[model samples]
Target: MFPNQIGDFKHIINTELLKSGIYIVKIQNNTKTYSDKLIVIK
Candidate 1:
């Protein structure tokens, strides 16, 4: 993640329930699907 940046949409994500590891983020838009790796350090 970038410094001073909250999120792509400026929304806060609840990372308190996430463990320290790599995560998969999937975004689906109709017939399209976007995926990205989410790394959480906690």
Candidate 2:
């Protein structure tokens, strides 16, 4: 994950992303929060 000071950021989820399953992604910044569910198929 890359850190951002201007309320902006970027990330790449390619590492260890070969398995097929359900995954959860979460991000937080100050009083803001984010979450998502991802489904992967082989």
Candidate 2 residue lDDT tens string, 1-42: 333333552222333553434333344555665644354644
| Minimal lDDT window, size 10, model 1 | 4-13
TM-score of 2: 0.26
Count clashing residue pairs in model 2.
0
- The total of clashing pairs for model 1 equals 0
Candidates' lDDT values, in order?
0.43, 0.42
Per-candidate TM equals 0.27, 0.26
Shift in Å, residue 19, candidate 2: 2.1
| Candidate 2 clashes between residue pairs 3 or more apart in a chain or in different chains | none
| Regions of model 2 farther than 4 Å from truth | 1-18, 37-42
